[model samples]
Target chain A: MTIKEKSEAIVEEFAIFDDWMDKYAHLIELGKELPIIDEKYKDESHLISGCQSRVWLHADYVNDNVVYTADSDAVITKGIISLLIRVMSDANPSEIYSSDFTFIDDIGLSTHLSPTRANGLVSMVKQMKLYAKALYLRAEK
Target chain B: MGFKINSIRNDFPVLSTKVNGKQLVYLDNGATTHKPMQVIDRISNYYMTENSNVHRASYNLSHIATDLFENSRKFIANFINAASYREIIFTKGTTESVNLVASGFSDIITEGDEIIITVMEHHSNFVPWQQLCKKNKATLRFLSVLKDGTIDLSELLAMINSKTKLISITHISNVLGTINPVKKISEIAHNNGVPVFVDGAQAIAHANVDVSEIDCDFYCFSGHKAYGPMGIGVLYGKEEWLNRLSPYQYGGEMISSVNFKSTTFNELPYKFEAGTPNVAGALGLERSLRYIQDIGLDNIFKYEDDLLQYATKKFENIKGVMIIGNAKSKIPVISLNIEGLHPYDIGILLDQMGIAIRTGNHCAQPLMEALELPGTLRVSMALYNTKEEIDLFADALMKAIDMLT
Candidate 1:
């Protein structure tokens, strides 16, 4: 599925939960199912700063697509990271790079993307896009 | 003069608010405190009627502003029981106050001179001295904390010598809430011929601080942390030290006379305070201090201690909850970590329940490294907080843990 399709699906999934607690519970469940990055990539080189919780993100370019893997020490941050990875991963570099990821706001988790939140979700998204942009530029060259 | 919790709660307008459909339980007093109605009104009144550039104009408004501003210095000097108002040099806040002193010392500290600071100091206190030592080619030594988050006096005594030029310590640890023996430390430092600078940012509101009694060369605290306005802090120095140290900044108000070639500096307090000061902030701060005085620090201390004990007992029974900093002497601050859950997760969940707390290193990264933990959730209470609020927080914490687990 395309990034938009996956994000919409997740939004729909989240829409079923009327209460904030249920929404958080769903996020927690999703956090457990995150595509774990290799332990080797979980070092300082892969670490994303500006977060209260430690987040490490790794990206791989394969089959003309970018695949993302990430982890966070905080489960709520991890949950947010899981959603971001699910939305942006397995897409071409240009597609991942250009997407604004407005679904975060649509799903009422926009606060996580705010710089003040400092949960690394904002940094994670930025890093993901930067990686995709770098790959896209290299491919153009 | 009675400790009326309800009336005191009413004094703070923000306490009546709600967050996320629940009553707001503000427990992050360590970060900054909400201003009482009196402090708020004081600032508003200053801006409305007494708005003028102090120490400059000859107008009536300016005179009123100047008197209010100068009176704030005197009030603060008296509040901390300093020798005179000249000892009270107003700066931006505690961080700026520390920086001002550190900047002055940078010139005096020579090669091989040492500065001792505890590992539990906030970044504001830790960074300035570290940079000062580095720039002057001096040594920076850290006094390690014991298991219960208290420092051993023997270790401090052993660390000081002829080479030790200064010892900057916090009156209370922001993260651990351990109240250090500032008086004892000051005595030790003075005996060793080393000046002591106490960072009273955390202690100023929670306890009564007398700079003269402590006999520390320098003591500093932020106004906002103590029920006052932001952007105004006090740097209390001995008259001799204030005279000896050079100005931190050079500008309009801090100068006696200025020429194209050279400039002569102003007297104590004014020398450190350059440019147009935060006159309104100072007035607000003075009013807040007065409010505290009327309430009485002893009464405030007793009430907070009861809240701390009540909260501690509740958290002690919770499974997998580890309370950090079990120091015998502490204010109403508690830092805790769950067995497997992260502090950020707990903090976010608690916020949803309208319970505000501080998470992460609390700006004491070295302390976190020493403790071998990432960070912990901290709940710092104040005069406005109550046992009922603590009970609510404890319940929310358990629910958050259950959900996360």
Candidate 2:
């Protein structure tokens, strides 16, 4: 499925929970299932600074698609990163770059997020797209 | 010393607010405080009844506004025990208050002079001096925090020498909640012939601040921290210092007369206040100070002291709950990091459970770096907060830890 479709799927799933408590529970569940990043990639070089929570993101280029791995010390931050990964992992670099993260707004996650968390979310998205852009440039070369 | 908790809670309307289907347990008083209905009503009343430009017109409305504005200055002067109301200059907040001093001191600080501040100072208190020192080609010396988060007073005294121009320090640290000995340090600074500036942003609200008692040359505090309005802060300087230093800003309200070639500035407080003052904010802050006076700071101090001890004991029983600041003398703010768990995660989960706590550096990056902590979860208390709320916060924190692990 396309990244947009996968994002839509997330929005649809989120729409099922009316209460914030239930929605957070859903997020916690998602956080629990986030794939563990390799120990080697969890170094300071891959770390995303300026986040209240410590988040590490690492990318690998497989064939023509860019794959991403990330982890955060915080559960909600981990859930947020996992959501982005679910939508954009194994996707083309151009597709990742063009993505606007409207899915977060559509799922009402942006509004629900605390100001600090929202900032962290923005940084996470930027880092992911940056990785994609780097890979895209390498592929073009 | 009778202090009623329930009625005190009732004064703050936001205390009754429910978040995520649970009663809000706000423990983030260090960031800012919840305004009482008295302060809110005073602000509304000022706009509704006395909305006039102060010190501009001889009209009745303007007269009333000017009276209210000057009365606030007097109230704050009396509150902090300044020698005179003329010594109190109104600024935006503590940050601006510190900036005003830093700007005024810039001319006096020559090359190779030193400005000393503690590592635990808020960025507002730290950054201005840093910039001022850099601009003046002076050195900025930082007093290190002890293991218990208190400043080493002996070490601080040893560092002070002939080159030291000014010594600025926080009365109470925002992150660690360590209450520094201002009076003692002021004496030491005076002995060294250096002026002292006390950043009372965290200290003013939690306890009584008497400039006379402390004998500090400069003491500054924000109104919002003391359950008052934002955009109105009090900067109390000794009349001697106020007369000597130049005005920080030049504008309408600050000038006595202006000409094509030369303009003479207004005297004392007026010289410092630049533009048309925040009359509404000043009145609201006056009422807020009156509110605190009505409740009494000593009573508030005693009540919060008991609450802090209770909360500390409760957290002590929790596994892996490592508190960063265990100062011998401190306020109610508790900054902690749980083992194998991040503060951000705890803050998020606590927030979800209708508990409000500040998580991160709390703007004291130097102190955080010194302590080797990425960040911390800070739970600061106010007079309105109760033991029951702390119980709820502790319970929610335990539940959050369970979920995260």
Candidate 3:
């Protein structure tokens, strides 16, 4: 399935269950389906601090577009990270910069996060974009 | 003997209430405690009858308000066994208190000075010192905790030297419940001419906190954690040191004179309180403190200690539930994880059963990383908690474990 189709399917599953307890299994399953990232990028430089669940994110700048690979220690957070990578990977720096992540609310899973956790999520995405922006800016320089 | 657990429950009316048809067994007291009726009445009465700005007013209402505000300061000084009322400086809460010290000392703490804190500190104690060190080009080092959750004393002693300027620490582990050996640590710092600051946020309610007994340079605690009002906290500095540190904020109350060209700050405690203080909250805090005093802190501590012992035994009986932080000295906080379940899921399940617990890292993310766990369900205790409540919590946990595992 296409990334959009899989994302839509994930979004649809969220609607099918209101209780987080009921949705937890599906969320863990989502994490299970995420492809293992290459061993080369799994290092300290890509580590995200302040997460109870460990998250490592790496971006490869191939031909001016960003390809993202991510993993998390917690199954549910990994799933969320996979969903994030699928939506964000391969997007151009300008497109990623201009895009609104209101898809968080659209998918109806934003409320499941605590305010601090939501802030951390925004921070994580911001960092990924920052990595892309810096790489693009360096190339330009 | 007159106070059965149920009878004592009247002091906390929130316990009797139902949330989503579940009885609220609030085990999250270490996070923030519920207010007693005396505290509630005192706060409401301040707003309703004696509402006025203090220290600068002379009206009848203002006189009463001013008197009450000063009385609260005295009450806090007495509560913490400070030498005099001048030692206590009121701020918004523990975070504000720490920020006050960090900001105030920034001028004096030169680039080479070293600041020490512990691993178990809430971000309040850790971050302010970190920012202070970062700003001044100094070093921020932590006293690591043992596998059993006690402070690594040898490591702490080795780290302290002539260059070490301050030792900031938490009195009790909000997550681990391990009571640090502050007195011994204080002795080491003092011998080396380094001052220590104890974050008494979690300890004030659980145990007796004597500034003189600990002999630390500074101590801070929030009122909310001790069954007092929110938005009010105290910073206790030794008279000599408090006299030396400059003001953190520049404003009306904290200063003696502010002319067009320059300004002079007030003496000691007033030098720290910058704005109009939380008068009502202070009044409420005093009442709550008086209530605790009347109940007897030693008695309360013994009772909770017993309850902790009982709860620990019961927790050990449960299968696949790993109880974290087995320090030799601990309060009633029980941090545990049921295998194969997220801490959030355990908290949600417990919430559904009417038990309130903190599910996340409990604001000590570094400790969580050190423990190599996502998070643990923290069931912290207060004076009012009973063994029966723990039994209820354990039964709920057993059910949660069944569902999750």
Per-candidate iRMS values, in order, are 1.7, 1.7, 3.7
A-chain TM-score in candidate 1? 0.91
Candidate 2 chain A: worst-modelled 10 consecutive residues by lDDT: A19-28
Give a tens-digit lDDT track for model 2, residues A1-141: 999899989999999998776777778778879998999999999999767788999999999999999888778788888899999899999999998888998988877678877887888899999999998898889
Using lDDT, rank the candidates from best to worst.
1, 2, 3
Give the top-scoring candidate (TM-score). Answer: 1
Model 1, B188-238: lDDT tens per residue?
998889999999999999987998899999999999999999999989999
Expressed as tens digits, the lDDT of each residue in B303-405 for candidate 2 is: 8999899999999889889888999788999999899777877887787788999988899899999999879999999998888888898888888888777
Off by over 4 Å in 2: A12-26, A29-33, A36-45
Clashing pairs in 3: none
Tens-place lDDT per residue, model 3, B115-218, is 99888888888899999999999999888878888888889889998889999999999999999989988999999999888988998888879989999889
Name the lDDT value of residue B221 in candidate 2: 90
RMSD of each: 1.5, 1.8, 4.4
Q: What is the TM-score of chain B alone in each candidate?
A: 0.99, 0.98, 0.97
DockQ order, best first, reads: 1, 2, 3
In model 1 chain B, where is the ten-residue run with the lowest total lDDT?
A: B344-353
